[model samples]
Target chain A: MPGVKKCLQEAMAIPGAIGASIVDYTTGFPVAMTGAAPNEDHEAAAAGTADVVQAAQSRSLFVSAVPHDLLEDLIITTAGGYHLLRLVPTDFDSRLVLYVWLDRLRGNLAVARRRMQTLAEQLVV
Target chain B: MTPAKSPGPGSLLTRVAGERRTGALVVGGTPGGTVYLAEGQVTYAESAAAPGVGELLTASGRLAARTWQAALDAGSAQASVGRLLLDQGHLTQGELELCVLGATYDAAYFALAAGTAAFHEGVRHWLGDVVSIDAAALNRESGRRIRLLNEIIANPRIDTAAVIPVPRPPRERVTLTAAQWELLVHADGQRTPADLAQLLGRAGFATIQELRRLAALGLIEQPKARATDNPDFVRLPRMRGASAPAHRHAAPESPAAGVSIDLSIDVPLDGDPTRAAVPAAVATSAPPVSTSGDPPAERPRLDRRKPGAKLPKEIAAEPPQPHPGTDEVLLKRIRTALRALR
Candidate 1:
């Protein structure tokens, strides 16, 4: 059961991880952040991440017809990096998103993605 | 907008943080809230206008009332209730921290508004701190929330007014979040957003925000907007009665009783979330007016429904038929998604 600080530290330790932050998508602000950010401004990165999460959650364009099939994670790959957003599932309205930025050359997408899943689960239950 | 006159003493949070003090700043107003700081960083906050951490937990069924009571009794003395819950395995660290963050931002939004504040040194919140936030960051976040809300719809009075569904909604169909759906279904003409917030065990700010969203979508009646002659009864989804819910124009006035039963019992509190997710059928009935063609003197024109009424299960159980345009929209999305995959 990692506390919030421990969770962020663990996320930073992931191979090739450049930055990690837990954002309250509802409010569009980062609750806790660690390591380096995309623009050297975690605040801007947090806002950008929130816009994508909000669009995915609210728009039918991204939502599936399959009942109970909620969005799990999204991977936004760039020329040099991968931005992964894992939606934290809670019973109530936390609307938290665990976001990690990774360097494409150094990080294995499969490993980083899987590590985030474990981290997200451990962050809660 | 704050009055241009008598300048209120600004938030003490910044000054306190500068001194690295630990205490609470109680903002005074009609619906004021308190912000708790540990070493000048915000650890927790609670507003009378919003549900606190405990209510959020019990209302969501994450923690039972008795369990909360037990936690309170055990940890109240040390101001370590939050830690006690975590140690007892009642809630995880992330759950506690995020919830604290949610409650803190929400309370601080209001606390920052009621400009007058006085700081008491060394006071701590009973829900021991999980994470701390910078005073500037908290202020920035609150400002962002206020701006975002106004960007959606600018009426602050909507927070306190009775949420009456219009007799005729503007859109043929509107999408609602599960939270929005729950709010509309339970909205009695009498319950304000704050009242509904406590009943639902949701954050008051969240309720206000969703109401603003509903107002933006033109789903619920806007405060002091021209009277649609909205009857006291809720216009539940028009599936059950003889009335035509899909009538693009107002259906000829059916007795309000024909379409909706005035909620007699408090809709079983959080009795069924799956049921709450089902949107209320859009009702399009003519305004209930006296045969005299003039509105009644006493506005509660709708018939008083018998006590012990539950929204007919069929109204919620039957899935709405997909609108013809929806399939096309879905297909377009699929095409776009598939092309991206390729």
Candidate 2:
């Protein structure tokens, strides 16, 4: 079974990866994380991301087509870095999310997405 | 300003500072908790872990949006928040307490997960002290119970984001508390138990308890965890309509049978109008004989007796014959007899 440390290490290896975290979106709790950012609470980031996902899903426009499923992935590009949120499929109750912070200058968006997707498929809960 | 203790790295305040922002960080426990303020204002709070304050008030369907908006707009400063909510009559003390308990737990579970740095902020306000209770302990206990319930139900997937799939009804229609029924009915494949608590305006612990109980009773489907490569390995079950039982326990024989038993005991001669009429005749006949001495007193006694027996017969006979004139005559006779006696 691949553990959280392995996941974080692999996530960090991606070019320009600054930080990575495994988050339990439901409770906005960070199961595990790796990064170096002053005063940043990864747990809060996980929770805030969950909140963002919830806000997005609440729109009626998404309701008709999405089958009420959890968010599969979310990407937000900031001036300094890229924020990636990926929702991993699990039991209906244990909805887990991955939050990745990538430096914008060096990170390849397409490559990062592909790598995260592949990694997600192999993660053993 | 003895630099109110600088929140350590990863504390709630540090995170807020890192983001360079400010807003009330409401934390919830199980039954009750406290609120913390920053900069001479309310910043953090704790309540029960179930339906949060915002959700409870909205779900209750009693307070209006305008009232909530007004209270929030007034600011979350400890003193102001309470006074404003009270002034608007959005909630009574008891109701507010319940809401706070629920909200505190909800917020605390989420907030604690975010980090404990939240408590290290330079400025802090303890609403627990304000309310005259150990809000922290209450919230902590509630939070722990909710987490335990989540684990016991083994539905780790049903967190804040994942919606709860509806469960199949039981074959032997089981009895459920009103809250459990409501929870089941409201499971819209989108709201987690926590979310439902907020939507339903219930405490988080209560919601989890009901869910755990239901799952234990085999009334709901439990999700199985699947291995995946994703760093986030949790798997939320994809919800689909649950299968109905092949044979439903027949609806409980109407409670009317029990009601009938009560009725029979309450009214022994319900069916016999003639038997009921006999009492009226006896009473009237006796009243006439006694009228010579004190007609007024005798008349009232007769009047009271008449209703006990005569009213039933009258109701059975013509069904609606006793009208305004008869009632007037009866009153007049009683009055006249009283005057005669005086």
Candidate 3:
């Protein structure tokens, strides 16, 4: 199944993957989640990802100066893990955000970002 | 409304899941629905209020109506329509699953509402299972949707009442989502959100959310504001002790509820839409022709709500000579400023 659940399963397969979740940032709701969480709670982690994504889209400090340009993704680095959030763009209101927690020392940030971009694309169709 | 001994649909589903049961839980209500679970995970749900996955797919132009019907006829009997759609290449694996996911959650939101439920053993949804939502997540999401709707507009009346757009919005420019624009275009001040949802072939609850958002932004007429028929009538807040109706309108009571909605928007003040949401009156200036049931002569508004301030043009327009109520706008501001100081 080339779907969100399957995509999340694939996200966990990425080396050093801790946890994964798909969130609707518009209301800070998690569409589906899997794997480990920063606080050992997927809902809380999903909510935090939504907040960061919301800020990136609305706040001038994080928003780009380009006209009508949308944000691609956001990554928060901690000593132990890397929290990656990739936005899913759709024809309709696509406030859907994808988040994956990665072990900092074991995971490759570049590889994780590329994999998430692919996962985000799978969600739209 | 008393199902005191009976478990709600939410808890029923939880119990079903705990037992690893497979069947359909039918919720009987005005617009009742059914939840199809596989081994306790919610595989699909359908509500009378919302368009099902088939309707959602066809309405969005992704799948043809004939194709959907064909798939249904082919796989509905064995409860494998989802697999048939994928096998027939009518919908991709991702499309089928995502649609099922969205439709399941959307329907479950309404299905889990206050209703009596009965479990039919071994019954199945024609669409079959694609993606499943655990009972906990399903409960949380539904609860969140309810909270989000109430948070958008405190008054419950707007959800059930007819959606009526203000005849003449006080603002010069207004922003709205495309879905909201469509709902407004179709609003006849007669059809409620549920009615509009079926008419538009959109998600039922999503339309309700949009309507509430529109009301919060003052784009649609509030149920209480319907009394003052004329949008141009600036129905000032009645003086506290004045002979206003003893029954308070639910809309204004929103802020007085101790929990304030952060209506202090961060967007620019220019062309703000919240202006029309001011208490009862939506007009920026005094009605030259007071078509309202209550004439300006006796029920003149003395308060200036920041919501209805047409500052830029009012400064350049002719003086307020015809309507005496316009002058009180300044006085009300001064009074408010004084109160703020204290």
CA lDDT of A108 in candidate 1?
Answer: 81
DockQ (0 to 1) for model 1: 0.42
For model 3, the TM-score of its B chain against the native B chain is 0.64
Q: How many backbone clashes does candidate 2 have?
A: 62
Report lDDT (Cα) of residue A55, candidate 3. 73
- Output the TM-score of candidate 1: 0.73
User: How do the residues A1-125 of candidate 1 rate in per-residue lDDT, one tens digit apiece?
Assistant: 88788988999888989999998776678888999898899988998998999899889988888899989899999999999999888765577899999999998899989999999998888
TM-score per candidate: 0.73, 0.37, 0.69
Relative to the unseen true structure, what is the C-alpha lDDT of residue A56 in candidate 1, on a scale of 0 to 100?
Answer: 92
- Please say which candidate is ahead in DockQ: 1 or 2: 1
In candidate 1 chain B, what residue range of length 10 has the lowest lDDT sum? Answer: B238-247
Please estimate how well model 1 matches the true structure, expressed as its whole-model Cα lDDT. 0.70
lDDT of each: 0.70, 0.49, 0.67
Candidate 2 global TM-score = 0.37
- Reference contacts recovered by each candidate, as fractions? 0.53, 0.00, 0.32
* Candidate No. with top DockQ: 1
Q: Candidates sorted by DockQ, descending order?
A: 1, 3, 2
Worst 10 residues of 3 chain B by lDDT: B261-270
Off by over 4 Å in 1: B1-10, B225-342
